[model samples]
Target: MKGLLFCVGLIMNCLFSTVSFAQTQNVSQQDALANTQKQLQINRYKYSTKAPKAIDGNSDFNSMDITSHGGDLAKLLGDNIYKVDSLVVRGTVDDVDFHTLWDASFNGKLSVINMENAEVKNGIIPEDAFWHSEQLNIEDGYITLIHLRRIILPNGIKRIEDAAFSYVVNLEDVNIPSELQYIGPSAFEQCENLKTDPLVFPEGFEKLDEAVFANCTNLTGKVVLPSTIKEIGEAAFWRAKISSINFPEGLEKIGDGAFYGCRLEEVHIPNSCKDLGIFAFKLNKELKEMHLPDGIERIPNNFADCCINLSHVNIPSSVKSIGKEAFQSCWCLNDVELPLGLESIDKDAFQSCYAFGQLVFPATLNFLGEECCTYLTGVKRIYSMASEPPACEVSTLNIGDTPFGGYDSPSTPNDIPVYVPVGAAEKYRKAWGWDYFTNFIETDDFPTAIHNININKPNAQNKVYDLNGSKVANPQKGQIYIINGKKRIFIN
Candidate 1:
């Protein structure tokens, strides 16, 4: 009887212990759940209380200030996601959060995004992070657009990948981070309303990718580039409204159409620049003057084409060839001294330059392209320093279609005299393109007065006369003349 009673007591004790253990486990789980709920409520309150009130007291329009630790923001915001017009994101965020924000912007609900206090994952804004496409109509097709008006990038971001913020038409204010090192191609292209004045890049920034700021028509004022930049990619600042820009010293190359169609008034290329692509500064109607540094070997095609107001340019001696249409259609270009070492002038290099004075070709010149100097109606004389006439293409069989055809009226015979080296007039008369000219004057003391000049004495009483003995009304620089009956050069 005693043994049976002991067994029953032991069984009862085991059952009671099992029940107690189950109750403790349930209580722990319940406590954890309650704490989680409490924390969520606190976070919700934090967001709601700090969020800015809607403008003009419109309750329908709302701005939210949210702190995201990471992951999809849509899930964190819950149903309040649709009401955001402006957002201030803080704490940690990732690409998933950016995708949600992009959707909100595309719906025309979000306008301003400020993430200055946020920390992006990997310190990089990934490629097309906020890019989205929408189909508007059958005829219009798919297009990318966004309604973001202002964006303050996080301070820790180091790189922004290609097309990250492209086609953000309403974006006007952007606070670029100081830690930014690289911005990929077309990152901000077509952001027409972006008015960031005095656009300044960070100190360590290395390059500007292709079409980075292209078509930003309202981006005016001075542009400050960093010294560490090496290359400016193609069409980087095309069609911008910038008035002035300083090219840093370490810059090595300027890609094609880099500054094309801009409103730059003057440009001073640095000596460190060695390569220039076609149309580098073309179509700038407001450009009045430019200075090309010494290391550039060739002036790329259409370098300054159609610059109507360009009156002065100093071509360095390092230039070997002037590319096709390099300075074509510059109506106001009147003062240019071709360097002595220049070897080639490509097709239509200086065509339609109406205001050009006398042209002096260097002895190193070997080839002249078709119509290279056509339509220079104002030029009175051309001094060919080469004893051997440079090779030129005869455009047509008729002499009237020569490079110097438009210098004289079509009704009258071609009378523009070409001055050649001593005993070289006969050589020029037999040359293919030079034979088109009817008159050639030979001179023994041709270019000596141009190179050797004594300007040390005061020219208060000295009278200058041209080689033709015509009294000069205005004596221009780099011209050979008989000053006080002595052959001398005058340059000011």
Candidate 2:
């Protein structure tokens, strides 16, 4: 009986031990699950407050201690797994010191990152924190600063705030999200090394604030602007290496100095642009031709100023006035047809334009400001198409400097004749500015002829032609010419 009782006791003891072991295992798992739930609750509560939407898009969340517990909790939940909040990627995955899996994996790739549905709990990644990374993928996070080679922005991103990626030199490939509506001032300015094949903006894009891409020297090639854009802010592309751009139809205003000092060769100014700002296309020497929109009543000051290579410009009939220095220093401009309704030519309007050979004054012109044509040395004659000379005021020197370009030196007289209607000679000879010219001649009829003839054709026997290729049998004094294929010009 004692032996039997001892065996029963041993068996009972084993049963109790086994039962206790099972109970302990169950309790441990439950405790782990509770801990995981608690961790998740903590994480959610931590990041929910500083979210972009909750804060009205104020991206200043760098002080929060953001951490992820999703990965650890997934393991605890068994096959019904939850996504891991791969926290703070700082070092290689091989390093044991790094607490999170994301940090390990992110650091392992050195410069390439691929995070799926990740939220950056921290307000922003501080400027230049990842200078070594060549590419990045954090679509669902706010990024204020980084040093990356290529960027694939998230689809949920709406607005690129002020100077968000300014001066990110290595950034080459950029995927601007479709939802982006506004790009703040200086967003990508001074990024001298950034290069892209063609920068295409998304559909909802509305505004390009001041200096957005200013001083990006390496940003060459064409830009495809969308029709949804309404305004381009001041100095937007100042000093960029852009070669050409086509403004979309819906564009309303171009801010001042928007394209100053660029290498633009072709520009398509849409008629929708009613308010073209001053100095907008200044210092663009490569621009060869341009046509202003018809609705503009006055040419803005410094319009196309200093574009040395500009040869042809078609000003619409709607223009009533030419502003000061509007086409100053356009050295290669050979011809411009002014409208009959043009009322005024402001001071220095066509100063230093050396290639214009002649000018036809309009009938509606009432004011010709001083120094309007100060240095047009190539002009040989001036025609007052209007029977009456335009009204003008005397300069500070008391001498009317209206058509001042023809004067080379005081000793070398300005002999370029000013032609007027046969009966209007007396009226012009006494006019305030017109009387200043030394040679004023009366014409019976209008001389509306341009000299562009093929000299290759068998030289017309006994037919005299001027140096400008005009048939002039009665050669004028002090003008260079070809008398039947011979360089014999009279000095009077």
Candidate 3:
């Protein structure tokens, strides 16, 4: 009876212990599941404006989206997620991983991406952040950045800061929003392949700042300036291969070197452009014609230097001064009409211009600079409409510097004819430099005879004229002559 009772107690204790162990295991598993659920719930509630829940480890995706915070999308979208096609992250993205986005977007194969309201504290899009995207769109903010080939900007963007969209070689199409007001320096510089329609500034746009399109060698078509714009900053189109630009009627100023090294063929400055800075149209080799605006008071120094292909220009009556080296080395300039109000001509103003055939000086002119008309090999006649000779810079009996390829002697070539008014010949002959002009005729006798002066082609049968217009059989040293119908200014 005692043995039986002890066995029963041991069996009951064992059964009780087994039940307690099973109950403990079930409760522990329940706690673990509850904790995991709680953690997921906490994560879900973290974002204020959520798009969708993102799977942490999934490789293939059917347009799965998630809220990414503090640039963590770089790690979550692993290297194996090459199969994922589209990703649309919607949140306040203060930080981002460009490399990961580039790769996980399947080398920019993910067709559609919308990074809207990417809030940055300073309103600057960091350099090269969106470098490789073939197509992109930014909305709801202006974050200054560069390098997207094709982009559509948001309407709320008021400014594009300096160096934005620079060096993007493949950038072709840019949809500039209507509300954009300012474009800072070098905004689209070096975008070698960018081509756009006529860039007409919106009504309220005020300025196109410095170097806005410098070195954009492939940009074609015209640019239409807005009437409200007051300034075009320095080097705005330097080395830009643009063919045409339209200056609005009320445009105020064009800054220094604004259109230097361009292919602009012709320009018509409106009357409202009162200020023109130095070298404004320098090195425009294809610029064949231009007309200065009526309100311009001066042509600044080096204003049109090295414009080798320019042929015609019409100076308005309001211009009072021509600056130093203004038309220096213009080899193909053939014709220009000077206005009556001009008072001064600066040094080297028309140097090395071999094709200028005629010049008419107004009576109102008062000053001429050193070497003002040096090296013009083809200038055959000068018509001084002034009754009184303009006061020259030097007191010698020489006009300006000695003609190019001429000696420093006081004698001029004597081949160039100076025609004055009928009664003014004696006064010019008595003037200091005027006596050196060997050929002088009244205005009435000048035109017809001067135009008939023969330029003989040299052959065994032809005779060459020395610099003094004297016929010589053999080519002489230190003399320029007409050989084969071309003016040769030689000193041998």
Residues 1-492 of candidate 1: C-alpha lDDT, one tens digit per residue = 111112222433421122221123234323422332221111111100123334345548677898898885888666556567889999888888888887777753678898999999988887666554331222323344566789999879999887677667678978678989998877887677889988888899989987788878899877888998898887788778888888989899887678878899999889999878777788899999899989787887778998989988878888889977799899888746788789999777888888776788888999987777877877777789999999986444344455554334431124667888888999999987777678899975544323456763325697777765687867777655678776576775
Per-residue accuracy of model 3 over 117-208 as CA lDDT, tens digit each: 33332334333333322222123222122223454444455566665555555567665556668886667765667787676677788888
TM-score of each: 0.79, 0.62, 0.62
Q: Which pairs of residues clash in candidate 2, taking residues 3 or more apart in a chain or in different chains?
A: 61-123, 71-84, 89-103, 93-104
TM-score of 2: 0.62
Name the runs in model 1 displaced over 4 angstroms.
Answer: 1-59, 135-138, 141-144, 396-400, 406-414, 447-459, 462-492
User: Model 2: which ten-residue window has the lowest total lDDT?
Assistant: 40-49
Best-performing candidate as measured by TM-score: 1
Model 2 stretches with alpha carbons more than 4 Å out: 1-149, 169-173, 393-413, 444-492
Window of ten residues with lowest summed lDDT in model 3: 40-49
Ranking by TM-score: 1, 2, 3
The best candidate in terms of lDDT: 1
TM-score, structure 1 vs. true = 0.79
Clashing pairs in 3: 125-144, 397-433
